[model samples]
Target: MHVSSHHQPLLVALSVAVAVFTAYVALDLAGRQRATAGAARWAWLGAAAVAMGGGIWSMHFIAMLALVTPVPVAYDLTITLVSLALPIVVTGGALALTARDGLAWGRLALGGLVMGGGIVLMHYVGMAAITMDGVVTYDPGLVALSALIAVAAATAALRLAGAIRTRAQRAIGAVTMGAAVIGMHFVGMAAATFTFHEGKAQRWFEASPVEAPVLALQVAGVTGIVLALALTSSALARRSAERKAREVEATLAEERQSSETLLRQSEERLRLAVQATGLGTWDWDMARDAILWSERTYALFGLAPGSAVDYTRFLQAVHPDDRAVVEAAVRTALAPEGDGRLEAEFRALQPDGAVRWLSTQGQTHFESGASATGERRPVRLLGTILDITARRLAEERLRASLQEKEMLLREVHHRVKNNMQAITAILQLEAAQVADEKAREGFAAVGQRIQAMARLHEQLYSAQDLRRIDLGSYFAELGQGLAALHVGQPVCIEAAVEPLVCDLDTAMPLGLIANELVTNSLKHAFPDGRSGTVRIRLFREGDDVVFEVSDDGVGSETGERAKGLGKRLIEALAQQVQAQLDINRAGGYRSLFRMPGTRFTAPDAAVAPTETVG
Candidate 1:
């Protein structure tokens, strides 16, 4: 059959129009394919294949109608119907393969081969259905070239279908793909050859055959319906995508609002906590040389709330004497070798010209150059300052009260010592005018006992701590005084006393007891040039103390046990201190007083004088 130029231009234009429309719908479906999943994704793929396949089938039939040959041509109904089904099957498979994520080159190539081979098969099969008293042959080289063009066009179409995104890009891709499809169809048509018999009777084609005009009308009707359905589906998919995007945006907006609410609540709670604890917060930006102080900080510094102050003002508020110390502490905290913690107590000069103590604690944060230099450049310093003025004032008042009490105690002890000394002087004066020798000795003994008590008050007045007396020193002095007063001949007085301390109540009783015992020893232990040693030993014994006064002399006579003032005084004093008295006369006269180590409470009144023990 010879080609006629009369209807060729119209056929080419119709083919191009159908191919372009098919490419447009295919690209639109491909764009929506990613936005769908599961059944929806397959639905879009099927829709794309139907739209493109129907258009391809329509274009093939329209182009065939344009063929003007010497003999009339008709298609076999069965083969043509089978040919129409080929594009739908093959395009569906190809679209499905390329629609998934991570499209592999091998899989895409295979899909191209399958789809191209199907198109070639469908075209040749439709041609084979032509029965017009003739046999058709294909130019092998032209057929091969056409198949190659189909494969190349299919591969490019699949790539564009998967890659195109924007509407303009999609349009461009559709036009390019349309040209490829049209080129493949025309090239395939060019490969066909037809031969007619000279005398064979014509066999009118059956099996659901139709004329070219009827086929063209059928193809146009089907293409129109398929494209309209595709446009409706694409519109619904876009609306669904927009609705989902709006829902996601609304969820994000709600989350942001919730986060802001929580932040405000957290800040409010922190403010309340700081206020309750009377903490003053501060932030110092070292690089900017600026300071931010909370309301409590201004109050702590004796300034109005919202008062502005910088590092220089802070230093000015510090007491002159403490300024250097505060500066040094801050420097140390910001030093590279430092631990970044600060704790300092310093006096601040308030606006009222009064000095107040402040306890400040803070931490330094290094934002940059922390590890690189001689000094760590602090990004910020955050901490609290507390007004410790009330505490300091209370402490000062307490210290003053303590000092005043100490002075009062010392005065009382001084007055007591003076009063006892006055009693001793009166006794000595009365002894000077005594008429009886025994009476004079008694007065002198009484005076010595008064002097012993005066010595205790004297120790209390002289010492820093007046609560307790050094018993060892008191006893040693007492022993020496008694020896000097009573002994006319040389009698060595030896003291073996350990370090012991006792309160005034215990000391007074123990001192009087020692005085009476020593006086008795000095008066009776030796007689008429019988020089001997009197030994006093005061020492700890377990949880008790033993005070022993012994003399190396003849023992007391039997009649001496009848009556004596010294013996009565010794027993009375021992009872007051809750001590047991033991008199030993085996080798020499020895008197031992054993008392509890603890301080004894004062008795209600003086005890009744006890019987003399010799």
Candidate 2:
């Protein structure tokens, strides 16, 4: 008996087209599932498997309904249900395995094999579901070829689904996967052979041959509707995701633009600040042996703008005397033990042969790279230079002016001393010419007073500080001169003059007072050639000074002697210095003068006189 499918060519073609279209939709859904995460991914996988399995089962039943045989055909309910389940289970497993991240080739091949085997088994099982009056047989060669075709188609479809990424690729892959599924179904159908009896009856609990076609059509229509719904949902979700991505990109672009604007503004402010301060900045790359100087730096060095120079040129511009010093300072700052700070003031020789004083402050920055054995090394020197020539010139001029003034002052003091000495000589010569004792004594006293002031100018001239006199030395010299003048009396003169300094204003008055007191003691205190000692003391007492002159001799006939010209001169001199005077005549004649607001100290005690003979 000849065994063949009596299915109508038009219905068979329609069923194949529906099955291929359904496969395309399922493959598209599976490709989308790869982008989903967690539970959502599984949902997409389940949906895709259901659509594909339903489409395959629907196509099989529709094609079966198209078949016409001599005896009526039916399907076993249990076996038909099992055939529907096979595709769904196998498709779900294959999708799940392919969804994994970094899916290896070995794993993909294993999944393909399992899925292909299931497809082949489902096709044969569905064929077994047919219950008829005749026995059905499958040609061993054709059946094997059909099974091989199913496995090959299933593997190819899975590979396409896994590999497809972009929408265009997915669309292409969809059509490809569709062809594979449709081809497998037809090849399996061609492998079947059925033998029919003369009379056949449909068994109980079997599907009616005529009604199966209508039911198959309904199932195919429902599967097509479900697939259409899934494709629509996927398209809407893709559009939503794309819209969100565009919004994010727009926000990022705006942020980047804002950041660039802020950075440009900051750099502009820094450039303005550097220009305003007249700062010449420099950056030296030690590793590259190159130097970058700001525009102001070229101006500072008397070079035109955009003039390029290396480190050697920079060094050559420095004054010969200061070049070594500047280089050493830079080296020290860059040394490992150094603190990376540089400070130097030196002279720079300009192109015009003009000298300029420059003050530089800098710091070294250490950076690590492939250089220096991967260790941090001083890679750059950043610094600023300021012109200081104006300040230096001003200071030099001030110093020269001070030296000229000091020289003029010394000359004035020398002239004053010489003029006063000449006046004293005139008075001494006049005394020598006078015959009257009172006149001689008066002239002698006047000459001594002149000499005392002359001595002050002398001390001022000899001293290192022209503004002040060493009073201790002045006093000692004054006492010895007074004693030398009073030659007749064998009086021993002793001085205990402590180291003290006083200005010309104070020294002049104090010297005159001392002159009168000492002269008076020599004149009257030691009477009738009696041997005695006269003592002079100049020392600091608290914040004041004490100038005392005392003589060990017979007391004066009357304290009335204090009222003479000598007394008048002493009183006048004391008043000028703002000093108080005290006289003692018990053991000897003593005159103690104290001047306030005098800040000076003696190395020894002043109250207890340590006498020195002169």
Candidate 3:
């Protein structure tokens, strides 16, 4: 009846593999059925029962395969009961979960207790199914071990279910439960081990009746100690986890409160700042044409604090002339033609019968299409407005001041020009009285300088405004004056000039140099009163102003240094104006000057002047 060691390894290996596979299939089927949402709890329980039944059958078949010798008739019946009872206990455990009938706590407890009893019964049945030497034997130790395992499994499941709150915790609970069940099962199986005599035979009726009680007591003591420790540890672990969860929840709630408090304080500060600055806030409902304005905005409009305002009502407050412009600006702000910000300044009629200018500036904040519910409507117009009445008045005063100053400047320049004219006339009379050749020559130079100053007055008086004078018109007049003074009838000095502008600083020096050059050209070039054109061209080139005077009368092939007093006068005047002077005597007498226009900054010389003398 003894089994050889050689067969033992193969039998044990096969038994372990089959047992593991059976456990896997049962758990897998139960898990899949339980995961189906909206499915009846009883349906899943029934499926788990079928799966466990299959597992029990597999376990039995595997144990049977390990049999090298046949079992006794009584032992065979006991083993069958143990195998059947194992699946029944597991099925009852699952059923306990489904039979709540709205009395959850009580039903779960009853289910666990019943399942534990089934496990104990199965253990005793399995112990009774063992035979050696043609004798049947029962083990009390196995029954106690099975009872301990059953109680541990049921308690662990209940603790796990209660401990988990979230899905993640529930998943961990399931894994922990599986591990705990496996561990308990193995512990119980280990405790069930006993040595049997293969060489002896015993009578079934009186075989070891006293020994059974002694063994059962020892087995019960061991099981009781182990079960107490397991329960104590499970309770401690669950309590610790719950305490940690409560701490985490408190910390989160405190953080949320702090954030809300900070947001409220920030909003209050913003409100105060807007109020202090007299800034008016408004919101427009595009669909309803409704407008909501802050209290400060109502004050700005000189309306009562609780005035009824909408798009049409707001527009009515605007001045009639400015209404269309303000409306157009609002339309542009909501749907702008370009990316630039929208701004408009318009006069508004206040409730107190005062007309005040107001400037508004803002950009659009687009609405989300999904948020189309009451009070959750999106914000569109986000902008501010300021009462600019004072600023507009100040600007008007500044403009008036500027106009008065310009008029005074023109009068001053006009008086200065008249004084120079008087001085020139005096110098001309003094030159008429001089008799000495050298004295008269010196007097003529003095007279020319006085005349140069006099010419400025003449041009200033003739000009519409005295801020600036046209360089072209001034030069042409100088040329004509010189021709009339020196070159008479037949020579017929003609000026071909282009328009240019010069301020007072530039006009003075340039006028003197022009007079000297034109006089020299008339006296020297038109020797026999030759009819020819004298061209005076003034144009801008980069940052410089070019002034050139050319004549077509006399050929200037003779190379000689220009020693005439007028020629020296021209060079000195050109130098005084900070201009480059070039006198070319090729083909005809020509003089060119290039001057920096920075010193002659434009005042009111926007359009070039057009004047011709032919």
Q: Highest lDDT among the candidates is held by which one? A: 2
lDDT per residue for candidate 1 within 163-195, as digits (tens), equals: 887889988888988888777777777777767
Per-residue error at 325 for model 1, in Å? 2.7
Q: What TM-score would each prediction reach against the true structure? A: 0.52, 0.55, 0.57
RMSD after CA superposition, every candidate: 10.6, 10.7, 12.8
lDDT by residue (1-614, candidate 2, tens digit) is 55565677766876777777777777778876877788888998998888877777777767776777766678887998999899889988987787776778877877787778888888888889988777787777777776677677777777777777777776676667666766777777776777766444544444474575577677678878888898887778767767887998888999999999999999899989888888899989888898888888898899987787888999999999999999999889987657899999899888999898999999999865534576557888999988888888998999899778777877777888899899989998998999999999888888898889888888777777776577777877887788778777788778777666668778888888878877877888777888888888876777888888888887664795488677887888888888898988778788888888554533332232344544
How would you encode candidate 3's per-residue C-alpha lDDT over 4-34 as one tens digit per residue? Answer: 2112344444444433433333343344334
Every candidate's lDDT: 0.78, 0.79, 0.60
For candidate 1, the C-alpha RMSD (Å) to the true structure equals 10.6
Off by over 4 Å in 2: 6-8, 23-31, 34-73, 76-93, 100-118, 121-167, 191-205, 209-213, 280-293, 301-374, 377-614
Off by over 4 Å in 1: 1-280, 286-289, 295-313, 331-341, 347-359, 365-378, 386-398, 413-614
| TM accuracy, model 3 | 0.57
Q: List the residue pairs that clash in candidate 3.
A: none
